[model samples]
Target: MADSVIEESDYIPGKDELDWGYEEGAEWGLLFPEANGDNQSPINLNSREARYDPGLLDVGLTPNYVVCRDCEVVNDGHTVRIMLKSKSVVTGGPLPSDHEYELHEVRFHWGKENQRGSEHTVNFKAFPMELHLIHWNSTLFNSVEDAMGKKNGILIIALFVQVGKEHLGLKAVTEVLQDLQYKVTHIQHMIQQYTVIFIFVLQIEEFRRLRSHVKGAELLEGNDGMLGDNFRPTQPLSDRVVRAAFQ
Candidate 1:
């Protein structure tokens, strides 16, 4: 089956124009009706109106990430993706009790310009870029592919990027951009080990201070002309309500 699967290619006849061709758009409803589904992602987060759920404030998170060596990086013509081999497990945040998710891959999205590129926006404003850390339920599912078909199967954490100081953690990743100018190229990276147990409990003011301090590469400045706008339009919130852990 793997041999027959047609992966996105770098030099596909007219792949560039398909960037904003929203696969989840209503226009494609006949083919992929889920594109018009109610629970679609990358919603605009109206931070002010987000409900301050006390339960969300206590969202338990256990990030067991270790220093990874020789991870694969691929430019699949759509996005620059880093396929992780680290046994990074993230459990608790936005999930029910005792369910654990394993980090499968990390990918990026950005704009041709710097105004907006992230899939999810805050208060309807766009960020320069965004990082999606994709994970799949580890307890019930055997593999990430198998887990993607069920509800609560996959959990994605989106981190928005602002143009400011250069992120040290991402700096190493960016250095390889020059080598990846051509598409369909794959390389192995000996990444720096920045290990931290990410506890997403936004409990108190002091903890909020800790939250601000607890940073490594969540925020990043834009690099010129890295990749064009690779983001989906913000979907309707529908019946879903936004929840926040902190003010």
Candidate 2:
């Protein structure tokens, strides 16, 4: 997938448009049919209920993220997003061995308060923020636009964020928030080790890091230099089974 910044023209009426907020997301299904799909994401990850798939343990989720010096960070009127200019790919785990998913963009979802920012919750517990690393099946499609909406077309790795000692890897992004506070304006800079560190922490570090913190809420200044809560409400999991790689 080629590195591309999100433009106002890329907004679909009911999909990527900024007409809606977290409060108005419930009505999205009425405008966009895909919002009501059975396999919708941001579901509550019930750890106790999630069945441990031993297969995931065997295959393991592998990531090959490289530093992107030509990346651009943009505030698209809703959230802060980073467009990847380098080719970073991941394979194995739940994905099919025949295809490799290429990282395209990284988006941050935050809230007005720390207690409820993350899109996905754990045992009904919400986190301060959430990070979404979006990827497309590069082996099967030419671009992210071509792969979207197709079955097994996209894969997103969601990571919950909590308050802690300052994260050196994310400092570069936070420092540039002032420059990209307005919509469409972006800063071209190197996002060094941001992608690699997060993926590594998620897959290898302690899972308890996801727990909420008392000081976690005010992590990032949103689009307009305020606490912008840009996230969709949790969707129904329906018949989907969330498989876990660990026992």
Candidate 3:
């Protein structure tokens, strides 16, 4: 039995060795103890229940992004990830003023059908897809590796994708998904203007107007093999509080 033990050196973070699937995520806690934690993510966002925090409204969510030329789109088995090479940061809003979270990577979560792709639901309703912009606390740590598992280490801005006309901002990235329709495949590509995409999605007015339609899965029709429904199921909120900027 001693030969069956897995060594730490052989472990790769974010690389699932157990071949876990979305339907089997409930069992993830068995292998990943953190998955069982009370603060686990992808909780349903209840619009009516979320407390309106004036602090978030007063400070506002601010992003400082620049045009990035050195970026790559990677299909890392589970999802398609856009690895950002340039330094971009977000401050204010729900985050503590003392720390600035630096943007690291962006990931997409989609579904097999148009009705249920998003991980977090609004009033028990699911969107067609979701986009996650992941950031790490750069003020306290040198890199994401050093910030892992720490309090206030990571910040994720999740955007729900609705069916609508083609989104020009997403064209560059979605077009590249065809080439990365295989596991672990990657391509060096510029993610358009990072500032334009982020600002466009973050603004409530702009987002609402642009939500009437998007190419949705039509653009990714034939690449279902690698891009299969990759969303995680919502975890229990437990004792955590979800605050919103709007009342």
- Per-candidate TM vs. native? 0.75, 0.80, 0.79
Better of 1 and 2 by TM-score: 2
Query: Could you give the C-alpha RMSD of every candidate to the true structure, in order shown?
Result: 11.9, 8.7, 9.8
Better of 2 and 3 by TM-score: 2
Ranking of all candidate structures by their lDDT, best first: 2, 3, 1
Summarize candidate 2's per-residue lDDT along 1-247 as a digit string, tens digits: 0011111111221245534555567687776666676656567888888887676567677899998788998776567778998999999866777789998988877666667778788888887678888888899899888877666677777788876555667777776765664456678988876532232233212211221212223433432334355667777777667767666
TM-score of 3: 0.79
Better of 1 and 3 by TM-score: 3
lDDT of each: 0.58, 0.65, 0.63
Candidate 1 lDDT at 103 equals: 79
Residue pairs in candidate 3 whose N, alpha carbon or C atoms collide under 3 angstroms: 163-213, 164-213, 164-214, 165-213, 165-214
Output the number of the lDDT-best candidate: 2
Q: How does model 3 fare in lDDT?
A: 0.63
Error of 2 at 1 (Å): 24
Report the C-alpha displacement of residue 50, candidate 3, in angstroms.
1.5
Clashing pairs in 2: 114-217
